[model samples]
Target: MIIRTQVSFSVTGTHFTPSKVPAPFSDSHDPGVIGTVGRFRGAPVPYGSAGFEAPEKEMAKIAWIYERVSPYKSAMRDAGAEHCTLSVTYTYDSQCALSFSQEELKMIVDLDCYFHVDCQTAT
Candidate 1:
């Protein structure tokens, strides 16, 4: 079963500040990330994370998450992001699968973004 959901986006570039991305939950800047595992590859450049960890109960549903993020498209586009990724993270205690609707997929396409889903199963 799902225990937590984080719907977020990230942008990276040498020319833009990440804090400018419109994220209400939280936002941060990292010089880089070091990775030792498969999914956590390291990035050695300016990185900004759009606020996630949506507190609103409705955000757990992907549609709502997309809706919440929709308004920030312009900010993301202008965030000086040489590249951008739109992602949804699920923290769960069991095995499961996720599905998406056309509307959800459209958001990614609309933004011309790379989409990734991170499923972390609790140990």
Candidate 2:
């Protein structure tokens, strides 16, 4: 029998850094030196946060892989089977931060496997 599973979740975090001006230019500068002076005030840049859904997808995939492989291998051994094949498929939904509704991300993965076991028969 073949089995498949799909999973999803929302993941979010502040993963991006705010842009900063160079060290010397960022510090206080004399106003009289117009050409050399740097602007002291600017709009606060918004840092980017990680999307919430990625981790969920990763965990789901891992669980599915483990479940499918381990049981199948055990079954094959118990049955004294010479070979077995395993396959996996996964799909991910759009992931976005709670603050942003328009942002979306998606990922998908698929894998296939073949296992072989051999037993020598008495001649």
Per-candidate RMSD vs. true structure? Answer: 5.4, 25.2
Q: Return the TM-score for each candidate structure.
A: 0.60, 0.21
Top-scoring candidate (lDDT)? 1
Candidate with the greatest TM-score versus the true structure = 1
In the range 7-120, model 2's lDDT, one tens digit per residue, is 321111132211221211112222222332235235332222111112233534434443433433333334333322332333223321121122111111221224212222
lDDT digits (tens) for residues 1-123 of candidate 1: 877777765556656555666555355563454544455566444444444444546653556555656677677558765676667788888765777778767766876677888999876
Clashing residue pair totals per candidate (backbone < 3 A): 0, 5
What is candidate 2's CA lDDT for residue 110?
24
Off by over 4 Å in 2: 1-59, 89-123
Local distance difference test, candidate 1: 0.62
Question: What is candidate 2's local distance difference test score?
Answer: 0.26
Q: Which stretches of candidate 1 lie over 4 Å from their true place?
A: 18-25, 28-53, 60-79
